[model samples]
Target: MVNNILPFDDSDLTKMITRQINRSWNFSSKVEDKLSTELKDLIRQMLEPDANKRPTITKVLRHPWLRDTSGVTGISLTAKTSNVVGKKK
Candidate 1:
């Protein structure tokens, strides 16, 4: 005999999706740093199921994370000999 379980319902799936999206925001929100209300609002917009409310990649790229990547750029500090010296190793 085979047993099958029905897939999650729409409301359940939406709740799961929103929880995942909000997890990212909730994490960033806790940081003692500058997190613009616009950025938070943009995240909300992007996470919306209705595409009309979503922001374009270009608009999201304009966010502080990309616009000011210096703070978050994960450049490893190691001495390596290469033609390109300053690049992250």
Candidate 2:
């Protein structure tokens, strides 16, 4: 969902698969319009070709981009739950 396009997206199935296996992922814009730097960094690390260099699952989950989500979650889930309950009653 980062750019509303899948990695190595193409009309030809074979070409798309080939690119996925052989090419590094990329974006069109000079700078991403919506993604944060932290997120971009995490994606880059995760995309590293060397498995030894990629972060562990725990590290990935603990990354600041995922751990600190206050910027993305404007309304707390608790508040949303309460609103839904009130409507039901």
Candidate 3:
């Protein structure tokens, strides 16, 4: 989840909405330093405010960074996630 860092994080709800609306937050130097180019690019694409500009689930799944499935098995929550796995929506 992008290092679990929230670029739009703010204590003020309105400010957080504004930041998300404007897409104005930049990753901090430390976070930027830790990200690879491919991952950064993917995050930017996913963050596009315009829904039409955003990548589809298929496209996201096909991204070079995500395509690396090594050591990644089916998701689990503690080999268990949300206790809602396989639950009917």
Off by over 4 Å in 2: 9-23, 28-31, 71-89
Model 1 lDDT per residue over 51-70, tens place: 66576665665555445545
- Name the top lDDT candidate: 3
| Candidate lDDT (C-alpha), each | 0.47, 0.69, 0.74
What TM-score would you give candidate 3 relative to the actual structure?
0.64
Which residue pairs does candidate 2 place in steric collision? none
Residue 17 lDDT in model 3? Answer: 81
Which has the better TM-score: candidate 2, or candidate 3?
A: 3
Runs of candidate 1 with Cα error greater than 4 angstroms are 1-11, 14-39, 70-89
Local accuracy of candidate 2 as per-residue lDDT tens digits, 1-89: 67556666678988776765565677546447577889888888776656888897657766788767575757554445556555743
Which of the two, 2 or 3, has more lDDT? 3
Q: Top TM-score: which candidate number?
A: 3
